[model samples]
Target: MRRTTRLTAAVLAFLSAPVAQALDTQTGPVRIDRIAAGFTDPWSFGFLPGGGVLVTEKGGRLWYVAGGSARQIDGLPDSVPDGQGGLLDLLIPRDFGRTRQIYLTFSKAQGAGSGTALASGRLDTEAGRIENLRVIFEMTPGSSGGRHFGSRLAEGADGKIYMSIGERGDRPAAQDLSRHNGSIVRLNRDGTVPDDNPFIGDEGAEPAIWSYGHRNPQGMAVDATGQLWVNEHGAQGGDEVNRIRRGANYGWPVIAYGRHYSGQKIGEGTTRPGMEQPEFYWDPSIAPSGMVFHSGSGHAPWRGNAFVGSLKFDYVARLAGDPLREVERISSPETARVRDVREGPAGGLWFLSEDDGALYRMVPE
Candidate 1:
């Protein structure tokens, strides 16, 4: 367990608002609506090309939502669903019209061992199945910790896919460039290491390593400028939002704003000379999971803000600032745990609840 600084009782209470003051919106205030229900620990959701959505449940199930009906997708790989290990992120290829490809990350089990795996397949919407599924990448061997599988996938402007891996709860692994755990990795759309990756020619290091030092990163998005951003769970209170840089080291375990759960300080101190500082951090631990940049036209002033989902605080936060600032927070009354949030394809917003397992759509009122 890690130690986190406690927030003031008043601040904690303020975060529990059902409906707070509305921000200046181009089209008035925003409201959220329930699109569907009856999800069992839903982890992530992705919108398809023509008004359908694919969702993954933590208990090894994939579902298709269309015409207001939820149907379980068939032909999914065997998954290890134990203690935060299960189906995770989902991404439809940017060129899906031409490629017909979909990517998924999940925990695979073999005997008593489990590790994260990334796979891609051609999705057959009419047949309601995934075809030609293939393993694109797998975590390193002997690293089987159930926690900190910081897995998220996003395609970069260069058409390469970027994946984030946590340190598997083993802090020392963050400094090990030779391991894929605790690193941001870049791979070609076809699952090969890009020749231009930061560690391309390094002998002992994985060629896909982009940046290192991360815990369980649940939220990741690339902005219009092609800059990558991520939000990760900190030990106790040091939940951080960071701008990912190529070849740079983000100091975790070694230097963190958070303490151990047992009320002990972590590593040496909070600030180190070479380590990058977080743009924004939550002291009492918001338990941020999903994140996306608000680039849709439905919310005018929100175009540049980053929206983050919180588990511990049960709110969606809007973060602003070139250096990142907490502009506002919107609490959800439906559930106490928000698993994921994304800007919808139709200029609205979509989010998933981890507890009650429901999908919500937000639009300008």
Candidate 2:
């Protein structure tokens, strides 16, 4: 009972129509189309400017998918595919048409361990390869475990690059400004620190640190209003969606809403005066990943709403309003282990399902 929903014509018609009213859910029946399949642990994907998509698999492979076909793209750096490590996120810059550049986040191998790394490269679709690939940044003093590489990328309205790195399973490091782990780092496109960074002249702090004390922020996006938002995983419960700010410390390991997996209490218990609070939190932990704010006429009713993928619960959570809260949970068989979600160019919602090993597009039916 599934069918393709043609949206190109409707998009054109919607362009000339009056603004549509926002609906709590879809205004009509919807269908999910399988964009491409056969992916193995696909981590992230981005739409190409012309047509098609670039997908990354945690096993260190990149694929160019389009027109129901897929081809591997060459020239990716070696990525360490240990537990919860490997190629993590892909970002297609707003200036891609002019720059032909793309950014990536991955687990870079470090001595006896690994660290979160940020890289940039030029995509040559005709050649099916990435050229001029180079590592722009790597977490300092890499840790000994393969866990907690909080690798997500976003380009701000001011044009600075933002990246998140987890505490590498070391709790105290989140509070240590000397290390890049457990903090969001802001940098120039060429890997240089911005002059106005919060810690430029500070004696024991990394210069690129913008905000500290975050734990495994896997999803990040810059909304239409230029506000940056992130969704991160919690130990057992206490997953959070936070509105990011400069020089702010989001308490980690120090204060949290959830207890440790073994039923032990976590640091100072939730509200610490100086630390910023989450705009929203999940008590049972959805194990969230991938984030996007919807826009455009194709999904007019959903404009400005936030969409996040839930890995543990196998669904996509739609959040909206001033006091952000989950308004809807879009779940189906194809949504299992939702790894990433993106707003398609035409304004349709597309998501990657790790369990299905496929990419799916949601469109009005």
Candidate 3:
């Protein structure tokens, strides 16, 4: 893979400019105010019905946040934290108020190996615990190695749950329909494959595949218009933010704008007629991990912008417009690796720090 030099201080400083008066909290762009701190390897979070937040730590712990205080919640299962495996994503069911259901994705140890696992349970808010926890699904048996656990969950307007599985460091597996690895799988709310899936009876294919040929997709969200969007890490310098579609092929090892870590060109080339291109991509790799559309009162001017976490860049990026026309990157006050970004119930931007493990709330400043 080609080794691109790091950005210079001057260049980084220019990119980290403070919000101007025109975009200030009262009249200018959106601003963020830090509210809470001190978390370890925070990964994903979801808001509770009453007014609390449920957060997951990559180190295998879950916490409940309310009124600026955080407390560990019991009833979490065992998780494999080796390599890139651990508690990864969390979400509240659409009928959360009625069913009290919560869903999560994590790396589970199967014998001596590990694979991604999806599970759900009831959140007993009054008791501050999870109940009736059960494994909904596990990656096809016998897969090992931890580089790619494409784990992100999104519930579509149609009420189907969509989950992404990484290629597990196996390039060709992405093109293989027989395996669930490296594909977007859609399931009914009860964890069964939807009968209307595209690959129902093809030879050796999993019926849950909605789209194939994806790398490690970590960020996923549904927009107001009900369109699903995904952000994935590229090989060396090609990080992409794509608008996902059913029955589509997102060229991975086959075609990439990025090169290998050894500086070698990846796949055949960047463009292929059948494969769909990303709506927006970053060269020199920001190592984007989490993404969410910004729609809150705190940042009025940025109401429609997309806020994404940058691990390699050590900052948060604000992408504006439908085709993502404008780009504004901001450095986090903590200067730690940003693992996840989400909109809080208070219309503020919530972020998790990967390295220092702290939870930060960004409100309009």
Candidate 4:
């Protein structure tokens, strides 16, 4: 294969003031080209088994892109696109080849409010539509606002689906196992509670909960060893990356390294007696959105590393080492907000810019 990153001395352009050109940086001299466009706050996407990619826009529309073109896919459930809540992540199941199915997380309309809902649909590529769309999971006690709807999905190595649900702007609910809010939930492919889930036998806890006490984890990626790692947003400055454990409680509102946006201390100090600590945290917050644990050697420099999209900094953080130190902040040609980042289908790196409503691929020059 060709080298993916070339060394250069010029600066990469920002997405907001895009020059439609590539820039050079320390990581490598890279070029960026738009793969698709016409998006309204596109959140996440995944490659299809046969070909093409499926993208979910926050406005509840799903699009299928192939051969440099994109089209809206029908048969989606109506979504409540209020504030930060809307259609979020797209998951391509492990058995996608046998079943042309995809899983989606969105803000579902509940009784008098909205909650995070997980649904699956069959992508009929030939007809450019979605079929057999069904609801698999929904968060309990839907909240009214749209502040924290953490909806990121990743299929684990053990044939189970892992979901990250935010606290729904409800700080206390994250500590309550009775509700699915503010949790890392594990479920079967059919949307049933996995028997191996941590709360399976709990008296009144939600059976789908795998771990609890998460703030607003927008990104989750299973590492090479099948370990689940999540990056969550802190109040003001405490964005965290934690290695997820079964049944473990990651302190959200209770113990956090960040202070409230209004300049107030959050819950006591940073350290609590029983709460799990983050493997890595950003002091001022990178506003982490998407993540991927790079495994293969397709890109020699990224092997065994993790790449995370930073909306605040408009760059991708390349993390390495056990403690997971950010080794480099890889800038893109477009300075627009990087909403999502993933390993590209052709082996380099792919990212979505929320500002420009476009998708770009980064490859070695």
- 1 versus 3: better TM-score goes to: 1
**Model 3 alpha-carbon miss at residue 202, Å:** 1.7
Clashes of each: 6, 0, 15, 8
Candidate with the greatest lDDT versus the true structure? 2
Model 1 root mean square deviation, Cα atoms: 8.0
Q: For every model shown, what is its TM-score relative to the native structure?
A: 0.91, 0.92, 0.89, 0.92
Query: In candidate 4, which residue ranges exceed 4 Å CA deviation?
Result: 1-22, 333-335
lDDT of 2 by residue, 227-331 (tens): 888888889899999999888899998988788999999899998988989999999999999999988558677888899999999999989998689988987
Better of 1 and 3 by lDDT: 1
Per-residue accuracy of model 3 over 49-96 as CA lDDT, tens digit each = 878777788888787766645567777767889788898899797789
Each model's lDDT comes to: 0.80, 0.85, 0.78, 0.83
Range of the 10 consecutive residues with the lowest summed lDDT in candidate 3: 1-10
lDDT of 1 at 231: 93
Per-residue lDDT, model 3, residue 220, is 84
**What is candidate 1's TM-score against the reference?**
0.91
lDDT of 1: 0.80
Q: What TM-score would candidate 4 get against the native?
A: 0.92
Location of the lowest summed lDDT over 10 successive residues in candidate 2:
1-10
Question: Residue-wise lDDT of candidate 4 within 234-261, one digit each (tens)?
Answer: 9899999999998999988889988999
